[model samples]
Target chain A: MIDVKSLSKHYGTHHAVDGISFSIGEGEIVGFLGPNGAGKTTTLRVLTCFHPATAGSATVAGYDVFTQSEQVRAQIGYLPESVPMYPEMRVREYLHFRGKLRGMTREQRETSLRGVVERCWLGDVVDRPIGQLSKGFRQRVGLADALLHNPPVLILDEPTVGLDPSQIRETRRLIGELAQQHTVLLSSHILPEVEATCQRIIIINRGRIVASGTPEELRERVAGTSGLIVELKAAWTEIEPALRGLSGVTEVRGTPDGSWTRVALRAAGDQREAVAALAAGRGWPLRELRREIATLEDFFVKIVAGAHEAQTVPVE
Target chain B: MRNTTAIMNRELLSLFCSPVAYIVIAGFLLVTGVLAVFTGSFKPGAPATLRMVFEFTPYALAFIVPAIAMRTISEEYRSGTIEALMTAPVSDAQLVLGKFLASLVFYVIMIATTLVYLMLMMVYGAPDLGASLAAYIGLILVGTMFVALGVLASSLTKNQIVAWMIAAVPLLVFVWFSGWISRAAEGWWREVFRIVNISLHLDQFNRGLIDTEGVVFFLCTAAFFLFLAVKVVESRRWR
Candidate 1:
């Protein structure tokens, strides 16, 4: 539903979104992940026609964002990063204004407003002024405004940022439900939220896409080897050699903790059986033994760190 | 056009919802009323017309109208609502015109409230109805020009106080200091400033003379600033 081709947004000499190309299929929930100042918001703004690209092009719902901004705007529902709202207006009144801006008729707006108010769990605060509502409620109001017209494409920037745990969960569930009918491109600096909510993730750093894939795919690609953490009531010198001698064990490192020692084993394949046998043979007390799979957080850190290092390295 | 009305309606709703509109209106009425009744001695056998009200309105509106118009676009920029509003299915022209109309409506209502002064004159003495109407028309035209200029100023800055000063400085020069500057010059330089003098153009309307030149001057002034306001807003997409 959205296609960005070599999109570059520059503020004078600095490119906020630099030659980043990505697309979202219809009805797909794509999480846009990046640390702060990673051009996530800039990309969304370019797609929404809020800001024109300095170079390259973007199209939404088959309409060019630059040339046919109104059509592109009509098809996309955008909830800006800041959740911009009129604090003096009531929740319903604010949504009503947004609905009208979306060109919804009176009856159409009323019906859509009812649906979003319920979907966003804004029923209780619908009558209250936005300034009086809590941050979570205000965030929900921003979401409700975006969903008021039922646009086919939803562009939400940091949708669940200020929400409490329960509200975050509910927002995740709502986005998951929304993916059934609408294509969603949401950005969040929080990785776990994206892992829990998005079907696919596109990670950007320094105005470029550093990685893109499913969470599991990213984990596998960035994670080189499977490993195990073993704690035994033995010295580091005693445990390291025994694990190193085991089959399929590539490397072994140990840390001494007085009477107990912790051994971390990196292996080419499943070496848990061999380590367990070695522990049994030694007649040493085994406190804890657990296999470790590289998590999405680890992969994200490695990828982002690599990108940051690449930029900082001076060229000849 | 529908989107324009929607924006205008929302802007009007926003204006009335806040205390700023009422406060500005009350302040405007007080200034104009006091200037008319006390300073000008506008009473029975003393012209007994809205001349004093019209005479001081341009000066009053120069300060007060900018105060009202200062927040129209600057507040959107400050609050980040400009992103939300710009992302909507509306043209830049529509947004500018919508805001212009909202400010115009507010000015009309504020200026309209002074009609009671006219009613009081009708009760106490015979006032020149034609000149009174002409003066009001002039005030509306001048008010339109100021609001447009103020909206343009607001579009340029995210700070409301800065927007107020940006617009107020030019207006202050035109209302209070233009003729003084013109008198300091000689020959065509004096004539040039005289032609651009806001008060000179407004006085024609106050004397019940509907000069096409004066009407066109104010209309062009309003149209030019409004066009500049639209350009200023649309320029954001580039930056």
Candidate 2:
């Protein structure tokens, strides 16, 4: 439903987004993952037609964002990062106003208002003024406003930023449900939220897309080998030599408590059985021995850190 | 057009839902009433009428209309609501025009409250009915032009105080320099100054003269500022 080609945004000398290209299918839930100042918001703003790209083109639902912005706007719903709202307005009234602004008739707006209020779980406070609500409720109200027009695509920037853990989980569930009907492009700096909610992930760093794939694919691509951490009730002098003597053991580091040592086993496949047998042979009590598989967080940190280091490296 | 109406309705409703509309109306009436009573002794033998109310409205509007319009677009920009509004399926022209019309309506309501001065003139003295009506019409035309200028000023910055200052500066120039130019210059320069002088043009209407030139001046002023407001909003999209 969205196609961005050579999309770039420059504020004078600073390039906020640089030549990034990506596309998302009709009902797919795609997560845009990046750290702060990673150009996620800039990319989303370009796609939403809030700001024009400096040197690229983007289309949404077959409408060019630069030339046919009205059509593009009609086809997509955007919830900006800050979720700007008129605090004096009631929840229902604000949604109704937003629906009308999106070209819905009064009858249509009324019907959609009911649906959004229920979907965003804003029934209890729909009549209260927005200024009085807590931050979590305000975020829900922003989501409700975005959903009121029932556009085919939804672009939400940090939809779960300030919510408590329960609210975050609830928002993730709601986004998952939304994906069944609407194409979603969810942008966030939080790794686990995107992993739990999105089917596909696009990692951006320093105004570029460093990686894009399914969560499992990214884990496999960025994570070269599986590591087994064997914590033993022995001194580093004894445990380090024993683990390094094994075939798959690559490195070992002592835990802070000094009561145990953690060993990293580097292998293409599972080496749990090999490590377990070695522990059994040694007669050393193994407090914990678990394989350390890389998660989305690990992949994100590695990619972002690598990008930062690459940018800081001096050339000859 | 549909978007404009939707935005206009929302803006008008918001104005009423808050205390802004009421406070503006009350403030305009109270100021006009007190000025008329205090200045009545210096009337220079002019007939008792709404002429006094019309004569002082431009001065009151130089300050009051900016307060009403200072936040029209500036607050939206500062609070990031402009992102939501501009990203909707509406053109910049529609958004600017909708906001301009909404502020114009509020200006009219504020001007409308000064009708009490007219009622008082009718009850207390034989005021010139024709001059009074002409002056009321002039007041509204001048107020609409000022309000449009305020909207354009508000569109130029995200700071409401800055917008208020920008709106007030030109009105201040018109107030302070128009008389100076009329006295210092002769013939053509004085004519040009009078033509561009908003308050000077307003004097013709307050004197019961329905000059078409004065009417056109007020309308052209409003249109020019509105066009500038639309341009300002469009520039933001590119930046």
Candidate 3:
């Protein structure tokens, strides 16, 4: 339902999205994983027809984002990253306003309003002014606004941002349910959020796609190693050299934190036991020593380390 | 268009829902009431006419209309709601027109409240219905042009205070230029200044005359500003 060909967007000399091309199939939930300012928002803005591409082209639901923007916008429901809303408006009224803007008739809007309110779990705050609601509720209100017109394509920019853990789970479940009928493309900086909801993941960095595959493929190809985060009270200067030579230790990255120091040690597997033992042997006070989860930073490190032939954009 | 009306409806709802609109309207009523009515601009024995209402209302509207329209587009930009709004199926023209018409309607509502003075005049004396009606039409035309200009200013900045200043500048020029028109004696420059002298044009309307020239000026001024506002809004897609 979405096709992008060498899409490039530049703000003056700065290339926000540089010649990145990717397509999403019908009824597919695609995760756009990238760090903040990775051009993810810029890419989605082009697809939503919020901004014209500086180069190349994109089409959403078979309509050109540049030329046939109204048609493209009609087919796609977008939740912008910031989730801008009319604070003074009630949830139902805001959705109704959005529905009207999408050219839905009064009856259509009312029906869709009812459906989105229930689906987005906005029934409690439906009558409250949006500004009065919590950030989580406001995010749901934005989601409900996007869903009110029932567009076939939904482009959500960090849809789960600012929500509590439980709210995040709810949003994920809702997006999963939506994928059965709607072609979903959601962008996020969090590794687990995207992995949880998206069937296929596109990992982008510095305005280019660095990797694309299933979560399982990502785990097998990259993340085959483990790292430990060791934080302890010690002389910052002596921490790295002291821990860099342990068996299976390949990389030691450390930074000073007052008298305490935090270090990330990349090793073959399960390095927490080794790191704890080293701290004990050296007589450095250990505050916290834990294995690193497969964070985005770790994912990038693995991709950069293993895939020299993968044309990876250097981690700047 | 449906899109245009939808935007306009939202704008009107927002205006009515806020206390600021009521405060501005009340301030307008107070100023116009103090200037034209309760203060004896139209004395008891003074001819039964709404000339005083027409005389000062344009200036009252000049300031009041900007305050009404200052938030029309700028608030959307400030709140970042413009992204959601522009991304909708609505066209730029529809959005601008909707906002333009909303401010004009607010102007009408505020200007219309002064009609109570007209009703009072009619009760005590003989006010010409057709002339008073023509004068009110003149007021509406002035408001339409001012609202269009205010919306254009709103499109120029995300700051409502900046928008208010920008909206007031050309209006200030017109008010000051009205004097320049009176000074220049029968020349092309005078005609140039006269074309821009809204007070002179509105004065013709106050006299129960709706010249094609004045009507065309109001419409053309409104159209020019609204067209610029649309261009300003549409420019965002490029940037």
Candidate 4:
């Protein structure tokens, strides 16, 4: 339930977020993937109404951010990149204050505070001072505060940063659960976390949207050729020539690990069988040979690198 | 209005939770009490009364109010809590008013603690109760003006120390140099300097004179600074 149209933010000469447009539907989990200084935080800040866009506009829950900011803010919950919390406040007290700030009555605040504490797994430390908690717990408290008002939209920037592996997994699961009820716009540099948690991904670079699609869609679009890495008891001099002579073999490189060779193959169709037979015919012991499925990480690297190349190339 | 009250409550609660409110009140009472006693034995100079308490308050406020307000907006900016606050369902005016009101309340509490001086005057000598009340009213008005200026200073920077310095410098200049400028000027220039001089306006109140002009002047100054603070915060959102 969020719509951003040609949104841009400039700090004098530095453009933090260029003309970027995207819409998120209700109950959909969208991940904003970008490296540092990639405008993810700027975009989220605009949607949350923390910062007004220098040009263009955004609407949340059918309210204009520039004119109807109060209504927009009332409908969206934002957890900024840095979880800003009062260290002196207890977990429950902080949640209560946040709920009141979001326009909840006393009874409503108590009810929502209970739900947030349980949902974010903040029960054990509800009475503890927030500053005394571990980083993981502090992150959870931040999440709890965002969820305190039960807003229909959530804008979380790097929600899983600095958390241990277990906490990260738990946060991912919580986000997945949240998606069933609330529209989530999550920003993160961790590719796997985005892949595991978001149904759609938007990759941004240098204040521009480079690509947007499902994880598999992006992976397939960027991964044009499939290859196999085979570890075998063979020398590069002996296996390189044979694989080169194959019908679909495009390139092959041997690693210094004398027993392994990575072969890049191009074929009109599935070429797994051709490579398998070639390995079988050579009678060279094949230890491992499997088609490499391109991952989100590979797609991200290729897209960002390609954007960098396009920027550097001179135009006529 | 609900949001403003909520914010005001939170700000007041935060002040009490820390030692800030208590320390400010205690320090103010202790200092003013000592000054009142020390000035009492001055051979009955200038009709010794609670006027000295009001006379020293603006100078005291020149330092204490900044300390109370330096963290109002600066701490939020530094800790990144301003992001969350700005995203709440509150307008810029509401936020500014809420913070100003909270600091004003603290200033009142600090001023209220000096009532011991009034009680002592009642016991030792027949100090003019009407004049004493008028002076107390004047002190509150001047204190409100200082609080508003402090809030403006806090809004200009995220660094609390810098905010404190910014707030204190202007106040010190106005209090100390306004008299100097008044002396340096002739007819109209001197009168204008005296009118603009905060301490000069405050002197009328301490003398048991309820000059409506002085009251309006302090209020207008407070409103002007608070308006500037709101504008500063609004401009920051675009940046």
Candidate 5:
């Protein structure tokens, strides 16, 4: 649904988005992951035709963003980072105006209005002024405005930034539901939100895509191998060597907490059965034993740290 | 064209829904009515006309036009709604023209309220019907030009106060001090200043004369400023 090649946006000496290339297919929910000021929003803006690319080309729904911007704009529903809205207008009034602005006929708008308000859960607040609503409601109102036209592609930047925990979970579920019919390209710095909703993740840093893959793939690639966390009613000195002595255990690090020792260690593979056997055979009170799954947060930290190291190292 | 009309509708709806619009309308009616009575030197048995009101319309609009036009684009730019509007299926020309048309319509409504004064004149004394019609036309023409100027100012900056000053200061100078500037100039300069003077363009229309030159002058000037506004708005992409 969207294709970009060597896209760059420069402001004087600063390259806000520098020669980034990526593509999103139809019915794909792709997460654009990056740190703050990493040019994620800039890339989204360029694709939405809100700003012109300084170099290279991009197309959305088979239309070039710079040359054929009108057609491109008609094909995409955009929710900018700030969630632009008119505070004086009511929710229904705002949606009606947005629908008209997007070139919907009165009849079409009237029909879509009901579906959109229900979809975004804006029924109770539809008659209230936008300025009087809470931040969570306002965010959903922005989402509702985007969904009004039912465009093929939805571009959202930081959709769940300021929502509470429940609101964030709801937004994630909403995005998951939206992925069934629409191509979604959402950007965020929150790693778990991306992990929860996106089919694919593209991590960008310093105006470049550092890594792109599924959550499992990124974990295996950056974290190398998985580990296990074992808590036992034993001292660190005893538990560490015992875990290291197991067949698949390659390394062990342990810390004594109160009356128990928590041992974290890496292994060759499938060390769960072997560790359980070892704990059982040792006759040590096993408080807890679980495999430590590497999360996206860990992968993100490793990728960013590696990128920083690579930048700091000088060529020999 | 449809997009332009939609934008105009949205702008007008937003303007009317605000308390500021009513205040401005009432203020225009009060100021123009008082100025008409005082400047016309109304007294018992004296022939009453809207000549004083027409004479002061240009000056009145110089301040009022900026207040109305200042928020056309500047508010959107400041609030980041311009991003949403520009990203929608609307062109730069459509946005500028839509805003200009909305302001013109609002100003015309304000001018129409002053017709009560004209009715009072008709009941008390005989007024020149043809001259009153000409004055209404002139008021609209000059008001259109000022609206375009105000839009151009709005496009240049995100600050409404700055936009108002950018439009009103130069307009105030042209409406009140152009004659002095025209007199100070010599030979070709004097004629050049007079040709560009707004009051000179208004003189023919106020005197019950509807020449093609006066009509074309205001039309072209309004068009020129609207064109500049389109350019300023389009420049956002480059930035």
Candidate 6:
């Protein structure tokens, strides 16, 4: 129920969110994945009508974000990244205040408050002041506030950022449960948080949509390749040239060994068989043969490992 | 209308919760007492009217109203609460008016405490009740405009101290300096300053004169500042 096209937000010389566009369909829980300072929060803010886009357009529930801000805001419930709240207000009072601000009637507010408080597990601390609450409780309070209006759309930014491990799991579970009733668009830098809760992941880097796909699709396309490691008595001279010659072998590196050579090769699919044949044909004594690293974190390390100036960030 | 009331109620709650509200109230009463009662106005031989209290109120409100209103918008901006607040269904006009009215209400409550001075007048002398009522109305109008001006200043910055200064400097100029500068100026310049001087407007009411023209001026001035506040708030998107 949210659509954006060619959106750009610039602050003088720095482009916070350069031209980028994405859409979240109804009942879909999409994860906006990006490292810090990525344009995720900026994009969410534009959708929530907190600010106007420098160029292009955005609509929430078919209401224009810029021109029809109040209507757009009414259709969506947003939890800001900082979880801005009145510190002095009790959790119950604060939620009621938010409900009023959303134009919910007293009856609607009362009914919604009960559901959200229980859903967010804000039962006992409802009467306690927010300032006195811990960070985890504060995050829950922010979540509860977002859910209190019961809008059809929920836009949450880093919903589990400061939570404890258990709280993180609970928030993920809550978002999963919320998907049944509300279309959610949550942004986070953590990979598993996105993978654990989102049906689709949109990876943004340097204000651009570098990748967007389902977790499995992303794993296959972005992290489909595996790394090859071979330990042998061969010299770096023969191993480098021969391994680089193999098909789908994109990168090769060697680490110092005691009168032995250990080489690491990054290649598409698997190159273990090829390397074994090469060692046999070259008449070099082979010690070990295996796929060095080929897990999700290989994707994490490949994309984020900085191992060889990876193609994670495209050269603009 | 409902959104406006919601914001106004929230503003009142926040105002009452902070120490600044009580400080402003106590400060105002202290200043008003020194200026009108303790120094001269309600003495043995002097006139036992609330004329002194009404005359000096605008001066006291010059500082008091800003202290009450500096947090109305600046705190939200500083604490980053403006995101949620502005993104709610509330309009910019509603937020501005709600805050302006909240400050006005707090000022009224503070001024109500001065009614004890009126009761004191009831003890020894025959106070002019009609004039006293007119003065109260006049003060409320002046307070309305002052609160609007303060809200406008608060909207311009996220610093409460800066907001207070921004509202106070012009307020002092409008209330105190205008009358003095008008006395020094010649020709229409003098008349211009005199007509624009807020004290001159309050003077008409101190004598129990409810000038419809002054009433319109106060209301229009208030509306003008509130309009500026709304514009200033809307300008955030450009940043």
Q: After superposition, how far is residue B200 of candidate 2 from its true place, in Å?
A: 1.7
lDDT (Cα, tens digit) per residue for candidate 6, span B53-158: 6787788788888888899999999999999897788888898988888888898999899998889888988898999989989999998999999999999999
- Real contacts recovered, all predictions: 0.90, 0.83, 0.92, 0.80, 0.68, 0.80
Candidate DockQ scores, in order: 0.84, 0.78, 0.64, 0.77, 0.67, 0.78
Q: State the lDDT of candidate 3 residue by residue for B1-239, as single tens digits.
A: 98898899999999999999999989998888788755474785788887876787777676778888999999999999999998889899999999999999888998889888888887888889888888888889988899999999999999999999899877977865565755764777676777888888888888999877889999999999999999999999888
TM-score of 2: 0.91
The numbered model that scores best in DockQ is: 1
lDDT of 1 by residue, B176-238 (tens): 888898999899988878877899889888888787888888889899999999999999888
Alpha-carbon error at B130 in model 4, in Å? 1.6
lDDT of 5 by residue, B44-158 (tens): 7655667666777777778999999999999899999998888887899999999999999998998899888888878788888899899899889998999999999999999
> Model 5's DockQ?
0.67
Write candidate 3's Cα lDDT for A158-223 as tens digits: 999899999999999999999999999999988888889999999887788888877887766555
Question: Candidate 4, B35: how far from true, in Å?
Answer: 1.9
TM-score head-to-head 2 vs 3, winner = 2
Model 1 interface RMSD, one decimal: 1.0
lDDT of 2: 0.85
Which digits, one per residue and each the tens of the lDDT, describe model 2 over residues B1-239? Answer: 88898888888877888887788888888888888877682265656766666677788888888888887889889999999998889899998888888898888888777777677667667788888778878888887788898999999999999999999888877765777887788999898787778778889998999889989999998999999999999998888
Which runs of model 6 end up more than 4 angstroms from their true locations? A241-247, A277-285, A293-316
lDDT of 5 by residue, A135-243 (tens): 8899999988888899999999999988999989988999999998899999999898898999999888778777787777776665456788888887777777777
CAPRI verdict (incorrect, acceptable, medium, high) for model 4 = medium
**Per-residue C-alpha lDDT of model 2 across residues A14-41, encoded as one tens digit per residue:** 9999999999999999999999999999
Candidate 1: Cα lDDT at B189: 85
